[model samples]
Target chain A: MNFAFTEDQMAFRDAVRTLLEKECPPEVVRARWEGKPTEVWASLSDMGVVGMTAPEDAGGLGMDELDLVLVLEECGRAALPEPIVEHAAVVIPALREGGGKTAQRWLPMLAAGEAVATAGLGEAPLVPDADRAALLLDDHDGCLHAVEMSACELTPLDSIDRGRPLFAAAWYAEKDTKVEADFELAFDRAALGASAQLLGLADRMISMTVEHSKEREQFGRAIGSFQAVQHRLADALLRLEFARPVVYRAAYAVARPGECAPADRSLRVSMAKAYAGDAATDAARAALQIHGAIGYSWEFDLHLFMKRAWSLAAAYGDGSFHRRRVGDWLQQREDSDA
Target chain B: MDLTYSAPEAAFRAEARAWLDANVGPFRDASSNTADGFAKLREWDRLLFDARLSAVSWPEEYGGRGASLWEWLIFEEEYWAAAAPQRNSQNGIFLLAPTLFEFGTNEQRGRILPKMASGEEVWAQGWSEPNAGSDLAGLRSRAERVVEDGRGGWRLFGQKTWCSRGAFCDRLFGLFRSDPTAERHRGLTYLMVDLRAEGVEVRPVQVLDGEEGFAEVFFDGAFVPDQDVIGEPNDGWAVAMATASSERGLTLRSPGRFLATADRLVELWRARGDRSDPAVADSVVRAWMDAQAYQLFTQQAVSVLMAGEDKKMGAEASLNKVWWSELDLSIHEAALGLLGDEAQLDSDWLRGFEFALAGPIYAGTNEIQRNVIAQRLLGLPRG
Candidate 1:
């Protein structure tokens, strides 16, 4: 009945927050906004944050979902452009579920910051060619196939989030390098990752809005003094807070996948995506609105978060898509009784 | 570090589950879905009270099983898993009973506790007023000092709105402005008023779910004896907050109840062959996860309270209130979204949809909860 974080969990959260504040400060985040930095991603890997969800035996941090969520929230708040979500949330879980000698090999590399990996969950119409990463996990024939990016044709698209470039890649599984019965789990993990990313983006946007509102003045008072502005900021804060637990809960479920029933887990992942996606989008939009004309200019960093939120919102599934999914789940329950 | 229950608690869970299995019927059976559903539910509550299953966390002096908080949670988990009937005396059991334990006189406890536990008396909250919804401190419900044959007490003459179950309840505990000249919140007093008093009237308000769960109660000089007062005269706010803190803080329902419903949701999804849609499955899974987090959060809160750390309940309960209400809404909204147009057509599903719609508006509103978190938990600057 105690919702307060344990001392260990709090210490872990503080450590992560401190690390992000020190190493990946706002300047580094801003730099990543202009161009992707392999070094920054590598630094996170070196710190063991990149492989937070990976097994301890695999040279990973072996942290639970809540730990990862705490880290991700800090990363989001700081607007740090690390591939922790890509590496930890997507790649590690996908590999762990894939399991075998392949996992034994890849998990260590992924955990050690030696290899950069990302998952393509068929979220978009065009597939991401794994050219930017060492490996690509794809959904093919109802099974997630892990393949080398060297064999695929990689093409970078003009994505909304310039900070994190999106590359569409085509890969052929010439031989079954590794096949797993966890397309759903991989999808959930990927969605959870997207949710984490959205949370970070939303949180940063809220902070930016709050700070800017306090400093920016109109009618001889800080714009924050205005009830309209205060209410908007409050609403954004609420959305971010609400989305936060959903992302963490989803990650927790994934960590102890058995703790949740399969359907329940699936529903949770979807709701997290839906809520986090919408929250991120809304917060970004509100942030931009609060900033007025200044936010629309490319000179400001607000666009970076706004674009990231937009991209992430569409990454796993949009609000309408998830909402419909929720509706269908409800209808199914009614039909069962009949 | 270990969140697992002790052996005794586990044993209690099994016993409770077995008892519930034999005694409780399916929750939504046709016969139990009528307007008198609360009465039917009260019967089950009385049975549980007789069996020492009701108010398990309350002290033995208050007619409870005097179980540990962990054991109480386990009892709830197993009870919900068995699809036990809803307790009609929940308002009294969850809120008033805890408040009485903390602030009530021994005489007050002796008189009220047993009847509440046995479901013989239903109690309702009389907090909100016409102008005081979220701003509860601004409540104008007046209680003037009155003389009854040289003995002094308060005579209540004001209106209260959004009083859930007030129309049906036998008694109400509420706040009133005892000192009109004093500033808002300074003059308030907590009084236990009989709903069946000579000058009292209760008018039910129909909600979106087509249920009259809430009511507006008017008092025309309704007499509340001095002995029935909770705590000091002007300290009603503290008592009210204590009651609210507990009500919002603890896990009122069994985690197993939500989990069961979530499982049924998935089963329905599969039955309709909607599992193929990754989008729908994802939303369902997300709802379930949110529910789990809520359950975990509630469990944590219960543990804290049982360990006699009631002060932490103030901020933590606000968190629980926000999270659970939003989760409830999200689960149903996800359900409605998945069902598409068909959701609007189905009565039961529609009721769930309507209930979800009201989630944010009730229990002091998610907006207010966030404000409390910002002002109280985070120490944010409030203008």
Candidate 2:
């Protein structure tokens, strides 16, 4: 069984990485804290990344989850303040599945970057980028709905990750808002996207820690030379490496849904989300430990990735919830085997 | 990337499963740790070799199917699913054979491989000495050149401990000090020594299970011919690294065994039903996830290798070693906790926990692997 990405996927990933490095540098991320313009989002949208996963018939690029995950990873690496993941991974899929005048109306808006959308489908109590979103896709009572942000009551909530603004909102949907697809699968897609982001963040955190460890001298030598510091970073690397393939597998399952059973796909997504959350936490902790006081400070670039890691670790079904999901499915599998 | 096997691979798997279903006995006998049991395992290996299943991925000339890495993984899955006996020749087939293919001369391969594949000569690794465990270069084992019967050879004299299956193994391979004045790693020479040779001794070292799972081999003047030398005489470190790579990589612990153990743990947890605690369930879930992760990582490695790309695992191998060993321990510990007071009694969980405890300590202890990851992989300066 081959697990190598296609050359085109690799090229696309590189292009997205180049784009993010140029448009969403650390300073650009820092500008979001001061309420910067949404120019970066516009640029990303101009590059057609916002609607990468929407159906071509729905005025989008019609890319699959695998392709979208690449862009989401870049967004996480840059700690991008925009809701590209929500737009491409969560909102687009929900709207496409909703497939009515509601989807037809906003799909073009989202595809053209004229409107931004965020989904409150995760277990998180708050919705991210809710103030800037034109549409809000909410999951309630096992039903998914695409509704306008203005129609919902919003209460701004401060998150540890200041880059992505969060708000606690109560959504009200009319008769035509409900989507006719498996909302569970839609949630898996969202969680899988979050997992991809976490993987990317962990990867970036490790790179930063490694660089810091090599440069930061203590007692006449770089701290990385110390076995204790090295071991902590190495442990972080292990977690990130293992978590990465799980995230990709989840993305693969989502992109090619017919290849796996629904329950199996759900279980895989849970594994990915659970493992990525834990790995990213390990990475953030190690980064902080390696960078010492600087990592914990607001002035350092490390906090940008660390806070997002802390935020995403609890987003879209925390580690324990996803682990429970996995346990239940395993129990079911055991019962079937017996 | 595809996870599904190709048509030929699927057919090969079906063939393997059919043969195993017909030939395999009950779950591997626990008694297989004994000398008699090992003999039975050797017979089983012969049976597999006759069917060209012993070395599924080995070249055809060496009595194998010459299958791809993917096919080999599939074969392992099917083989383990059938609860087949352990491969008595694994140390030879998996570790040494790969090195032989990489570094051995044509003559060496011709003489050594056929017997190894057929289990006519079971091999043990003699890398660890009493003085050299984690730091293998500290080994004082020496092999001095000699002219025996007008032929160039070396006389081995030293001790090698922690050789798994050494008590009954017919041959062993390891590094020796070829140049006394040379530095730690430079003077080493990789040699294939016969355990049955004169002045050789094998003393069993009983493990916690009260079985002679390993042994300490002492050489008084064990003779190894010049042809037995692998790679150059003084540049054996590179050769040893290749074997060590196999030892730490996919060869030493294939995903099939871990997957099987995870399955067993799940079954045990499920049998409790209402008695299944949430904590235990969570641990089981993590174990299952780790096993799947290991499987997927291995698939990715195989896929990359198949694409003709050499992704040096290096420290990543250490990461894998630590991950699987800990995962194994956690799974067993969870099962034992589920068993509660009954864990005091003899059970698979107890045996598994005992075995898994050695996993981190062996194959260059998990601590050493972490050091490698930190220093070699993370670019951490050596302390």
Candidate 3:
């Protein structure tokens, strides 16, 4: 069957691309390498992008996973230093799916762009102030612990990417503030969110490399004219394309939740994460290679992308971890068949 | 955006299924476990063709029933569901028939379509040359114009490799360089040459499966009349591309085909009493899911085209090609893994393994598909 995007979806994509082009132009992205302005985040929140997947009642856009994925891809393409994935993909969904009144009270604020939210999954040292939100939710002992009025020191990590500022926070749970019945669902949502971000990062890397190859020339021709470079770029492109549907499929599974078999969903998510992780890293490395000396320079903006690629890839679980999960899932299926 | 089939489409699916059961034989029995067991499956294609059920979407003037696109898809799904016999005239019915319909002269269609539907004239391709494989445009197959008895025609002289079923096919469709000086991809002309013509030779190349599915054809001044040309002189490149595109566009291998093989693999695992191993069962389920995904993807593509949308190919096709190719290899690899040391020796499983190895190399390499997405779809500057 035809895989062409529907007219509405295509229009939506163009709208998102145009918005990012105008608001988060390359110069703005470059300027906000260290951290974006509060007003810029506020504007995105006003535009309903931050709460794209949140329920309409919760002041969110209530877009499907596919819609959110489209926006995330544009965000990646522009290399915009915004927490769209953190707010839209993770925090908003985590709060709406029965994170309780504590979550409800803050989700709308997060959706309205009045407040900022960042997920602290797999981040070591569990810094409390890493997130600037009024509330921080963490899963421990099979219960989600929601803390209010966090007061802890936040130290920004010396990140390779000036765009994404990493923070180390000191957290105090205060009390056993258990909130959602299904913490695993939240975890899956977070994984899907991270996977979406990885998809965007990977896509951007390929775009950046393609642009560099066209403009960068050696020996009277663009390096892209050379087959060696072409083959590598082609390989990177293939990896990105292959990983794309997996990410969307995983997001689809997460959105539907119980509609899919657990093992099937888990296997797909693992495959998406594993494949996207590897592809993003590879594409970034290839981008660097194609860019050559210019890519390695600090003055050039390529390293900013390379850093984001590395950080996002390893943010959740790495490729090997997800690969083994996929393998195990396959093993289970084989046994069932036998 | 929707993936569900319409109500009428679903009802048609049920009707087609019932019809298939009443007409065709039962599914291939797993007990027929011999090496050539696939050949023993009943000829369901003939039954369908005889009933005017084959190629349902082709025009009514041809052998097809002139059904809607959705109806044709419904027919395909039901036929596969019933485990119908593989089309013995796939080369003629799928590849050549479509090409003929698109570009053939009125006389050509009237002459070839009926025989192809009835399975009387099997057709094979003769495009690949000895020195030209992937770079098909660089082929040196020469067809010089000649005047014989004051009438003009072409005398073909060349060697073609990878001509599948050429040894037994009734006709061969090929590209020949009509203008030697007209540069690559420009001087070629498409011709439908009789395989039994004088000065034509065929030599079969035995594959790893111990079957001769491919052959090399040599033509030494074999004459083809001007009427035999499918399109304009020295315009074979477009025809070739159309043929190749059709070949790629045809739905990926039917799920029923893989389901049959997967079912066999499951039975083998059971016979060995290794069903207790969860790993083995898991692999079976994964393979089943992959086959299902491919089936769904094909259905989606067909649905979109049936809805009257402009159906350009999708990246998913490439993904499907790569995934199915690897799935074949992986299933065999898993089969070998399950068989353990028994897999090392020559067995039916080993033959299956060898056959699956060629999946990636044929019908355009997966590498080429990747390059296509990178350069074309992704807007990556061509290198």
Candidate 4:
């Protein structure tokens, strides 16, 4: 019943955090809004985290979702402007599961950070970073197909989160390679990765507000001294603390699918995604309200993370989407048993 | 990161399950839905105490199985699943027992714990007063030093209100300003007093649920022997703080009870909920998932407590307090929403909602908890 992470996992997460601090600070995130290159993508690939989920057979780290979830959190904490989640969490794993020639072609490049990719999985529209991707994977009725960038007609969509540039892609279906492995698990991985990132964003938002409250003074004292500001941030912290472990448990369940109870692994994944989304969004709202006009401005770094929370809150599966499914899951399971 | 229990833990769970299955049905049927079921409830407590299942985490010397935190958590899960009964001795067993173990003299342990374990003495807290609900340090309850015929003791004076179950409790424990000259949070002493004593009056008060679960306890020169004093005479604040975490943290409201409520809500949804009503379905699922989140959080928290030199929960407990109390309310709210018009009726869900209303208000209020989290946990200024 021990739920503590191994020291190695802890150290690895710390190292990624250190690297994100150095390479993908808020300025770098700001630079993304100015058409600057996401050099952090190269830094992350050099750190071998971009392909952390690719199998050992593909010269990758062969890491578990448990191992990669923390790294994704670091990416989210940085608000790193890249497709690390879609590339590593979804596309590479989907390719590896395909176990075909397409997997052989993309595995080495993606694992070594020589190339980047993006996906539209679980029937979610708007392939992120599709314009720059060398390869694309799209989900159709729970089946994954590897698509080519050159063949797809791309239409760009502006995001409130500038780091994430989305595009509507129409690819040539006949030419794309269809992966024959399990895509349901790939969807869970996608949700897990996004959820872990949302957690990181949530933590960052509360911390920024907490630090701001300590320094920003009004009414003859630190604003944090007032119960109004303190209580709002405290409420944010409560949501994050409770949401975090559920995400970690989802990571654990994803890494060891057989160990999942009730043998319905998707429910855990959805729980993490839904809870993280709500927590992060709640934090974003609190961050904005607590920071007053400062957090509302484009100049403030708080908006960057807050916008990321708002965007990701609806991405993958929003609270409404996942909640309804889990609701149906609960009712259907009972019907089956009865 | 392993979530599966070991053989011994599983065996403990199985033993607990078997015992609950064998006893709980008769216990519930005999005790529930009666005019006055206090004796039946005490009988159930005795039944549990006799099996050493009343406080599984307590030491074997104190009538427990001496279970680990994991085993205890499993026991709680099983207990809530099958034996879900209101604990008559909860205040003593959950809230005070931890503090008692921390600061009690060996004699205190020998004298007090056995009675608490055996349900011979039900305990209630005497912290809040008419003047000091959230501002507990503002309490003016006094316990003056006394000596008569070569015997030393303390004479309690002043009032303590909102004493949960004080209407029926056999004993009460709280803090008193032993030194009148000392200001707030100083010169205080923690003491245990017998409710049956001559100088104490327990006036039953009707709570929001209209039950006599609360009492206004007035102390008028109630004599408590020196043996009843916990910790140093004027250092009661520190001692009480050590156990306040127990009241606000995982000890008092474990994930087991919420998870049980969540499962019941799902059942209610199956019986009455509509998928077309996405909002209500969403509420049910979110409540269930929140319960899972709480359970996972407890696992992480218990593991943290298992390590570290300062094993007691600090300000992080405020986070736990806020989460579970609200989660309890929400779960019951979802059930009531499923019930619709019938929610106003005298049902268990209505009763649960009323009880949960007290959660955010009691155990130092969620407002106080938030301040503690901000200042202590987040290192914000206490201006």
| Model 3 chain A weakest 10-residue run by lDDT | A123-132
lDDT for position A262 in model 1? 71
Q: Model 2 residue B156 lDDT?
A: 89
The fnat score for candidate 1 comes to 0.16
Clashing pairs in 4: none
On a 0 to 100 scale, what is the lDDT of residue B156 in model 1? 87
- Give the TM-score comparing model 3 with the true structure, all chains together: 0.83
CAPRI quality level assigned to candidate 2 from its DockQ score: high
Clashes (backbone N, CA, C under 3 Å), per candidate, total: 33, 0, 23, 0
User: lDDT at B211 for candidate 4?
Assistant: 70
| lDDT per residue as tens, model 2, B1-383 | 77776789878888998999898874367245689888888888888899999998888998987888888888888877777766778899988998999899999999999899898999999999998999999999999999978999999898999998899899999999999898888999999999999979999999888889889999999889999999999988999998888888877788887887888777777776343567777777888789899988888877777888663355568877888888889878878877878999988789889989998998889888989988887787888
lDDT of 4 by residue, B1-383 (tens): 88888898878888998999898885654322232554576777788899999898989898888888888888888878774677778889987899889998889988988789787887889999889878889999999999988889999999999888788788999999999898788899999999999899989888776777788999999999999999889999999998898988878988888888888899898888775887898888888888888899999989988876766787888998988888999999999999989987988889889889888988878888999998998889986
- Per-model TM-score on C-alpha atoms: 0.79, 0.97, 0.83, 0.96
> Candidate 3, residue B196: CA error in Å?
2.9
lDDT of 1 by residue, B200-315 (tens): 99898876566777789999998888998999998899898888777766745445656655655565556663666766766676677566656655565555566575434667
Flag regions of model 4 displaced more than 4 Å: A261-263, A335-338, B29-35
Model 2: per-residue Cα lDDT over A1-338, one tens digit each: 77978898889889888988898888987888677674788888778888787778766898888887777888888888987778888888877877878888888889878899998876555788887898888887778887788888999786788788889888776678887667888788878988989988998999999999889998999898888898898899889888888988988898887898889899889999998999999999999988999888888899889888888888889999999988878766634320
* Candidate 4 chain B worst ten-residue window by lDDT: B29-38
